[model samples]
Target: TLPVLAEPRAAQDLGDWLRELQAFNLSAREHAHTPLSDIQRWGGQAGQRLFDSILVFENFPLEDALASAGRSGLRFETQGSTGLTEYEMDVEVSLRQTLRLSFTYMRRAFDAEQVAAICAQMMALLGAMGTSPAQTVGSLSLLGPDEQAALLALGQG
Candidate 1:
C-alpha cells in the first residue's frame, strides 16, 4: 500500500490527495498487468534469496472487489534475528480513500506495541486535523493524556 505521510497543515487538501492517489493506483495496476512485448534479461549474483511475508487488513470500503470478496486471514511464523528485514505492512482506507489504520509486522525490526502506539497517535492526529485543518502540525494535540505524560517523563530523564 502507498504510504501517505502527510502533515496536519496539509489536512485541508487530504481528500483531494487521496482521490488522486486512488486514480494513480488504478492506472498503475492497469499498466502493470499489460503483457510485455519483449522480456529483458538481468544477471545477479549466485545464492541471492528473496523473502516473502504475509500481511492482512480488516475489511474496508476502498479495497478492490477481488481482494475483498472472501474472508480475510493471515497466519505465519517469522524468521528470527535476520541481519536485514523485509518490509511488511497493511493499511485500511475509508470509502473515500482516506487512510484509517495500519499494521506493521516486523518482529526483528520493531516492537509491535511501539508500532501500535504510533498508529494510535496517527489516528489522534488525523482526528484533530480533521476538526481544524488550518492548524499547524506542531500545534495539533496528536497525543492523549497518557502519551503526553510518558513524553514528559522521558523529558525528565
Candidate 2:
C-alpha cells in the first residue's frame, strides 16, 4: 500500500481532484515498498498513525482463484474476524459486475447512526460527482433536500 498525501483544493473540480490523486498515486507507486514506520518518522509523525480511515479498491479476479482452489479440492471459507484493524474505519470497495461498498468501523469510536450518515453522505457525494464532475469540491452538497430543510428549520428556531 502506498502512503499518499491527498491535498485537494476546495476550488478544484472533481475531475481536477481525481487527476491530482492519480498523479500522486503514480508517483507514490515508486516508493510503495517503503516502510510505513519510515514514512511516519520522515513526516514527523513517528509513533502515530497517519490516517484513521482507509479506502481499499479491490479489482482482483477472486472468482478465478476460487475456482482453481476448488479444482484442487481446497475450499476457502471466510473468516469473521481478522483481529487486526489499526484504523478506526475501513471502506472496502469490491469492483465486480456491480460495485459493493462495505464499511468496517470501530464501534467504540462511532455508533451505527453516525456510520449510516457517513455512508449516505458518501453515496450522495459520489452521485453528485458522477452527475457533475466539473462541480467544485466546496460546491458539492453532502446533504439531501430533507436534511437541508431540517437544518434550516433548526437554525431559524
Candidate 3:
C-alpha cells in the first residue's frame, strides 16, 4: 500500500492538490520495492501506526485473472466482506468499465447514516473538482441546495 498524506489546504485548488498527489506517487514509485518494515524502521516508528484510514485501488481485471488460472469448469466469485477491517475506515475503488467505490468503517466509530452523508459529500466534492479544478478547496460545497437552505433557515430561527 502506498502511503499518501493528502491534506488539502483551504487556499489550494483541486488541480494543485491533484498535482501534489501525482508528484508524490512518482517519487514513491522510485522506492516501490522497499519493504514496509524498512520504511517504518527508517521513520523511527517501527510499531506505530501511521494512518487510521486506507484507500485501495483495484486496477486489475479480476475476472480475467481468475479465468486464466487453469481452473476449468469452476467458477469464482468475489467475497463482499470478511467481517473484519484492519483500519478505522477502508475505501476501495474498483477501476472497471464503470468506476465503483465501497467504504467500510468500524461500527463503533461511525454510524450508517454518517457514512452515507460522508459518501454524499465525497461525491459532491469529486464532482466539483472535476468540473472546476481551479476552484479553491475551501470554496467547494459539501451541502446540497436544500441542505444549505435548511441550514440558513435554522440559523435565522
Candidate 4:
C-alpha cells in the first residue's frame, strides 16, 4: 500500500466526495467484469490476483451512496518485467465499491507521458481536486534480458 499521508482534511473532505465517487466506482467496477476483447486483457495470474484483492471489499449495503464511507478507493501503476510488458489497474477497497486503476509502464524508463496519464486518472476521483505533478528523478537501468530482446526485435521490425 502507498504510505498513507494521513491528511486530516482527507478524512473529512474525502467523505465530502463520496456521493459522486460511489457512482463512478460502480460504473468502473462493472466495466472491469465485462468480457475482454483481447486475451492479454486477463493478464494471467498476477493481474488476476490484484483484481481479486480489490474486489474482496464490498460497497456499503445502501443502494444509495455512503456519504461517510469507509473504503471506496483505488490504486494504479505502471511497471515492467520479464518477456511481456503489461498494464494493470484496479479500484481500491471500500465499504462501497472502489475503482483501482493500475497499469505497467512498458519500456526501459518511466517518463513524463506516463506521469501525465496518471495525473489525469487521479483527477477522476473528484471533479474538483488538487494536484502536485511529479518530476522523474533519475536514470533508469536496462530491462530484463528477455524484455530487452523483445524491444530490440520491435525496433528492427
lDDT of 2 by residue, 27-143 (tens): 887898899899999999999888888888777857667878998999987668842366888888887787778889998888999999999888877777888888898888898
Q: Is candidate 2 or candidate 4 better by TM-score?
A: 2
lDDT of 3 by residue, 103-128 (tens): 99998878999989988887776777
TM-score of each model, paired residue for residue: 0.42, 0.86, 0.77, 0.22
**Local distance difference test values of all predictions, in order:** 0.52, 0.82, 0.79, 0.39
Q: Give the TM-score (vs. native) of candidate 4.
A: 0.22
Query: Lowest-lDDT window of 10 residues in candidate 3?
Result: 76-85
Please tell me which model should have the higher lDDT, number 2 or number 4: 2
Greater-lDDT candidate between 3 and 4: 3
Kindly indicate the candidate among 2 and 3 with the higher TM-score: 2
Candidate 2: residue 89 lDDT (0-100): 86
TM accuracy, model 1: 0.42
What stretches of model 1 exceed 4 Å from their correct place? 1-88, 96-99, 153-157
The TM-score of candidate 2 is 0.86
Ranking by lDDT: 2, 3, 1, 4
* Candidate 1 CA-lDDT value: 0.52
lDDT for each residue of candidate 4 in 44-136, tens digit (9 for 90 to 100): 533232321121243453333443342466333335544222333233334435443333343544565864555454444232232211211
Instruction: Pick the TM-score winner.
Output: 2
* Model 2 spans with C-alpha error above 4 angstroms: 61-64, 67-74, 82-84
